[model samples]
Target: MDTTALAHAFTQACTREGFTELVEVEREAHGLWDTHTHPFEAKALILAGEIRIRTEDGTDRTYRAGEVFHLQHEEPHAEWYGPEGVRYLVARRSRAG
Candidate 1:
């Protein structure tokens, strides 16, 4: 689909889904969840509040609502709620060899 068409499709999909929809989920509070390297890279968008992320390189960042960020495959990292708390949508895809 063209960009416009693809966007329309996504809009429809988002609107059709309920807020409390159940998707694959894993909750980890400081090493509680598995942190194995992902087979692919990924990205996440902050839908509400703020989020704090720490990378293996010792780098850290915070993302607020409407903000988007990326994660490279094999890059170790951890994510948590910022002072105001946060919720985000995480999108991932396996890397192509």
Candidate 2:
């Protein structure tokens, strides 16, 4: 996928969807993160590389470039990047309902 193009499109989509605080994130290779929760709803688009997200229910899903993922407010999860690391665009919004 064209990461640069995807990032730009992702940012635009986030704004159109009423998401604020959009930002770019890059993780290091082989990075491992512990369980955590989001303060608000969040969404992200995978621009490059891959990530494995572990939900509170113990399900692990790996997302690669060109995929999107979301988390509800206060959702519990953990994530780690593949050996080559990952880059993505993320946006957050106030929770409704």
Candidate 3:
């Protein structure tokens, strides 16, 4: 993966272990990652700023520092940050069951 492109999207620390990867992202403007699902478990932790994750159910949930979210691969979701952007970390682990 192009670390620079990923960085351009949002400044973050990305690391991979086997099929799992974790990324710490900080955005300065409204940012969005298209909706999709993988065969793994995904989690995002709000470190400083705020963001919202839109689930397939149309439920929108906001998270801030000290908050964490967990989603399974079967659960498709889209993500977006607030007007001021967001600072958070996302981690993914395989669930290709």
Best by TM-score: 2
- For candidate 1, the TM-score is 0.57
lDDT of every predicted structure (CA atoms): 0.55, 0.90, 0.70
Name the weakest run of 10 consecutive residues (lDDT summed) in model 1: 18-27
Worst 10 residues of 3 by lDDT: 10-19
Q: Which stretches of candidate 1 lie over 4 Å from their true place?
A: 1-36
> Taking the tens digit of each residue's C-alpha lDDT, what string does model 1 give over 1-97?
1434543443354445322221222333332222446655656556556667778888888776666667787778777764555555655655555
lDDT of 1 at 22: 19
Candidate 3 TM-score versus the reference:
0.64
**lDDT (10s digit) by residue, model 3, range 1-97:** 3434544333242234332577777987688887987677766666677788889989999887667677877788988888878876677777555
- TM-score-wise, the better of 1 and 3 is 3
Tell me which of candidates 2 and 3 scores higher on TM-score.
2
Compute each candidate's TM-score over C-alphas.
0.57, 0.88, 0.64
Clashing pairs in 2: none
- What CA root-mean-square deviation does each model show from the true structure? 8.3, 1.7, 7.8
